[model samples]
Target: MSNNTNKILTALAAGIAIGGILGILFAPDKGENTRKKIADNSKKLSDSILDTVKEGKNKISGLKHNLRDRAESLKESVEEFAS
Candidate 1:
């Protein structure tokens, strides 16, 4: 993974955690309710991160294929021109 991607992911996680904690703190609720909310938010954050990772993997794979194709095409052209 790139440095920028790492930074973005880290920032996103921090933001979500801070926002969730603040929201919970301000809301008038029982301890059990607060815990449940925290659990639910954690699960959602986990799922979101997984989805983002999968998407980045897919995009990288696509770029790899695209670059490979271009390289192969250039090689073929060079061979044809030399012959």
Candidate 2:
């Protein structure tokens, strides 16, 4: 699940970066303005990526806790059955 999430996030980031670059290239703005726009867009993209990573981390942590609990429950059930 983590791997799948990472793949999705990576694809999303790639798409955003590609779209931003294309937009910047096609814009008719002056050099300085274009550079600034690119910088701003890059910053925004970075922030979005960071947020996605944080969210993924939280989800993974929750999954880990749930799996641990399930494993504990299974272990207890096995021990009772064997007694």
Candidate 3:
């Protein structure tokens, strides 16, 4: 996704998560329980997001390497044909 789209989605997610947490805190549930739930959910969300970003970076790196190899091979073939 584009940087702008990522920023928008991130803002939306933060808004939603914060709103949900506020709702839970104001509900009849115990404060400690509500806080624990929020903490756990936030941790899980962060971990999942981090993992996704790492995977994307790895994929991009692999593509770069493959493209570079292909370019080099093409260069060699052209040089051979020129000789």
lDDT of 3 by residue, 1-83 (tens): 56985797678668877886787778787778888888988887677767876786788799999999999999999999999
TM-score pick, better of 2 and 3: 2
Q: For model 3, what is the error of residue 12's alpha carbon versus the real structure, in angstroms, after optimal superposition? A: 6.8
Task: For residue 27, give model 1's deviation from the true position in Å.
Answer: 0.9
Clashes of each: 0, 0, 0
- Give lDDT tens digits, candidate 2, residues 1-83: 56887798899899989899889979898989988998999999999899878887888899999999999999999999999
The pairs that clash in candidate 1 are none
lDDT of 1 at 53: 84
The worst-scoring run of ten residues by lDDT in candidate 2 lies at 1-10
Q: With candidate 3 superimposed using the best TM-score fit, by how many Å does residue 50's alpha carbon deviate from the native?
A: 1.0
What are the candidates' C-alpha RMSDs? 1.3, 1.9, 3.0
Query: What is the clash count of model 1?
Result: 0
Local error of candidate 2 at residue 81 (angstroms): 2.8
Between prediction 1 and prediction 2, the one with superior TM-score is 1
